[model samples]
Target: MIHSINNLLYFRQKNPGIRGSGISVNDPVLLPVLSELENLKTSLENYLSDKVEKLKIEISKGQANFPSILHVSILPRNQKVSNGIYVVMCFDILGRGILVGCAESITNPKGLNTVIRKQRGIKLNIDVDGLRPTTKYNNVFENPREFYFGSIDEKQLLDHISLSLDIALYNLGLAKKDDLTIAEKADTGANDQAFDPQNLADARTKIARQITARRGQKSFRDQLLRAYEYKCAVTGCDVVSTLEACHIMPYKGDQTNHIQNGLLLRSDIHILFDLGFLTINYKNKTVILNKEITSSYYGQFKAKKIFLPKKPSDHPHLDALKFHNEHEFKQG
Candidate 1:
């Protein structure tokens, strides 16, 4: 039963694709004991160093190469210090052919919050680094509070650390077996529930705000990527990596992350569009270059209507576009 639960956790964290499947006899058996092996390895390395050294020597003498294994041990309910007990196993893939083991207890909200905070922070960090940045690490420290709460105390910290180590081992594939009986049962109930589009939309709104707060204008770029389906709305340039999401309204003026306020365009066109050198007229759905722009440079682009996937009613939020025309555009 313990092994089955371990496998379930592993499947949920690593192989999300297999999460809904009910446990079967054919399921892997080694998942639960894997963490235990890692824990035993760590204990031997620390308190029984001499024994570990002797074991390594013996293993090395064998003609076949010995693979490292790890064991982790979870405290039984009688000895558990928190609401949830966890253990981890780690394999030494490089040398020594040994495994490491560790365990921890997590009970309070603070402990759970810490895990959530770290995952959120790491996800945002990855997203920002993968995109563009104007200032040196500007987004990195913008909102530390958004990731971690102030209520995390030392006790919770210790609990979170242990749970995180177990999670890390699970991620590293050092567990014995998985058990997701609870999740499987829950998923069946969820499948029978009615869908709520409004809830999904609300979730998207929240996600957009979080993304915008962390990534700034790059968030708008992602919006454009989705709005235009990764193609340039004006020139039909499908070079996704080179495409830019241009805000019809200056980002400073309209802080909203509405998809309707953005457009996907080539990098050069994005610069022109933002500089008041160009404007898209909603009345006629045409791209209008300012007269001041020399004909030799922008003549071909003037008065040319953009090719957007959706109808005009679906994009360039009217209020936002009006603000840009009144404040940012260079009048003819």
Candidate 2:
């Protein structure tokens, strides 16, 4: 039943002179058990390998230096297990150890925790926020969850592990590596549309998170509103609460949050802007509609000029407008 070499060594270390006359370290009876363990390891590896490859991320050796382990960089650099080692999870004969770094980033951490507890009969030893720091493995995890092999069928356990990995990868996709600014971290918990349909209930959740960050970052929106005279740059809507601040270039750091790199737009227009259905021409500062939207209600704004700030210094930077037009604007 020993699937790892470490287990064998630990056993021998604890019991020195306990072998029978016919029982040696290399007993023939042990060979079949080791062979069966090897088959199990292969099955687990193959199952995980396919999942890893689909995520376009590679798996590496576990920092624990244990056999049958897999490590992935699902967390950001700050929360990594170590400087160069980002082992979010590791595997062994018993079961899996997951860092669960995305626990806070998930839209419904409590609900997901309840599901895991009910379905797997295992409760994550999580803090109030579903994240608890651990000094184990030398400060390895801020939030950790362990699932050991038990009465549950091995195949079922593996399936649950795979699903958990998918959830981690889904959050990882929303995380942009270039933008490590602390201001954006709160939005990381937004649900991945690919993982759940709840995203449709609040369609604005995606860009709204980027705009508001929902963590006392009202200054960014307030500044944009002041610069644009509390109006939607495109529609000229004067509702203060209905307008949002959007970044011309995705927020990379605090420096990118400048007024020149922002747009004050109505909620729906901000969604269209983020989705690339509409953009502003850098040269004339006129609204440019993607050809696909020319027949839609949005078509009226096709050559419409966007409202510009009175002070040229407060106007959207031409370079920022060019970047979006070239990179994000959908011409068709």
Candidate 3:
């Protein structure tokens, strides 16, 4: 199948504009099956258009699910396949089947080996909520499985693609100018949440992964917001929507969710803290600003004391603060 695609692309490269008996070179992206699926392509495009519109509407109601993903691609050895795209097949939060395919070009063998931590936003981990036994399609495909969107059921696949133009449009106002050529049957093999939650003994492992990955931080953030009265510690910006709960020690495998380890900050302030432009001296309990921050509003907040919770025990951990100051802060 791959070899055939290579041949077709090679012919098109040399003999351009000759959309002879085979698939149109314009519609180079396909499922590696039948060439006569203009009807299917139109249906998929229409489906995507409707879905994006629906998502745009739902955003106002706060019911939108963002389809951010970690995407990776590889250049096959054939050199003829110009565009490589990974087709991610899985289920959504509702346990209903879903698939997503997006194109990313890898020019050479070295590019294939590079792991793209491109989209840092948390993906809806399919193992936890996606492939559960809510519908009749439960046992049909493997749990936490992925394949090309069209491979499962050709008739129904177009309706279920998760990649929406709305996502790119919303964030970047990005639209593909050309018919995006895609490579199929390529997956990044990244299971951010690894759970084969079939055995009784694996309960600990499953719970541990959940706690380390997502659920713990979510709960911790909520606790911090409530504990600190949902105000930014430095500037007293109380806009709930613009607030973010930031960790004193970096969010990683070793971090703890103790309320003492967090601060409720405005989203921009949180970013500044992460990027080392802002920091707090735990012992002196004073906010410090890097020299790069020339704004009067930010300069006024410099050397100011941060608001602490009423309970002394809920104060920021000195060790976490030390780690941040020593490792994260731009002291120069």
Q: Give the winner by TM-score.
A: 3
Cα error of candidate 2 at position 59, Å: 49
lDDT of 2 at 16: 25
Rank by TM-score, descending?
3, 2, 1
lDDT (tens digit, per residue) of candidate 3 on 1-332: 22322333333244332113233323434333224223333334454463333232110001122111111111122322223322223233222224233222233211111122212353432321211122212122211233222235442233223322211221122323222211122243324546553432353344334323443555676678888887888888876656776888876653566787888888888998999989999788789888889465688888999988888888899988888998999975
Between the candidate structures 2 and 3, which one is better when assessed by lDDT?
Answer: 2
**In each prediction, how many residue pairs overlap at the backbone (N, C-alpha, C within less than 3 A)?**
27, 1, 0
* Candidate 2: residue 281 Cα off by (Å): 0.1
Model 3 bad stretches (over 4 Å):
1-212, 294-296
lDDT of 1 by residue, 104-140 (tens): 3332211111111122224332111111122112122
TM-score of 1: 0.36
Q: Which of candidates 1 and 2 is the stronger one according to TM-score?
A: 2
Q: How does residue 76 of candidate 2 score in lDDT?
A: 36
Candidate with the greatest lDDT versus the true structure? 2
Better of 2 and 3 by TM-score: 3
